[model samples]
Target: MNTMTKRLTAVALATTLAVSLAGCSHWSKRDRNTAIGAGVGAVGGHVLTNGSGVGTLGGAAVGGIIGHQVSK
Candidate 1:
């Protein structure tokens, strides 16, 4: 990837982090757990796939489901 792509990825990740942090204070424990799971899944996916879009999305979806189920 080029420098521009890397910069854009960084910006997107930063934006996601900022938004997630901003809304957490008002969320229930369940909601916070799900979000945390998704974030971890995204990072895990990125690492596992060398930052492939499919892997990231798959990880987020799977992580979200697992997190939601665990909250029950």
Candidate 2:
């Protein structure tokens, strides 16, 4: 990736992490699990798909659903 792309990707991941963690304060266990899953999924997707936005979002959605279901 070029320098600009790298910087943008870094900013996006940081923003995603911050938003996920920051919004989870006082959340229920299920919510926390979902957030954690999404975070992990995003990172995994980025790695597996070479930083694709679609892959990242898809992974987050799938992971969040799995996390929510597993918590029940």
Candidate 3:
């Protein structure tokens, strides 16, 4: 059981890292807002929900808005 749990945890970590890195590489400055939003959302989500999903949504919204304003 312990071994299985460890394997699953490792897979989840790898997936998260891959996704973040892949996202950074694919988007350019033109889409900076989107990237920022996502990052903020992630942090917010954690903070807002005590590491729950709600914080993520809030962070995303705030980040996106900030990014947009910066671009303008």
Candidate 4:
């Protein structure tokens, strides 16, 4: 990827991480799991798809759903 794209992706990942952690003070275990799942899924998707945004998003969605259901 280009320098700009890498920078943007890093920024986005950092922002997502920050946002997810910042609001976790009151989150339930399931919420935390979902967040963790989404983060992992995003990274996995990015790796698997060579950083395709659609794959990353789709992975996050699927992971979040799985995480949410896992706690039930």
Q: Point out where model 3 deviates above 4 Å.
A: 1-28
Ranking of candidates on lDDT, top first = 4, 2, 1, 3
TM-score of 2: 0.69
| Candidate 4 lDDT over residue span 1-72, tens digit each | 876776677568858887878878898989987887787677667756778999899888887888788888
| TM-score, per-candidate, Cα-based | 0.69, 0.69, 0.49, 0.69
Error of 1 at 71 (Å): 1.1
lDDT of 3 by residue, 18-68 (tens): 577575765666476666556655564555465445655676677767776
After the best TM-score superposition of candidate 3, give how far the Cα of residue 14 lies from its true spot, in angstroms.
12
TM-score (C-alpha) between model 3 and the true structure: 0.49
On a 0 to 100 scale, what is the lDDT of residue 48 in model 4?
A: 64
The 10-residue segment with the lowest total lDDT in model 1: 1-10
| Residues 1-72, model 1: lDDT tens digits | 665665567568757866876867988878877876777677667656767899888888877777777888
For model 1, the local distance difference test gives 0.74
lDDT of 3: 0.60
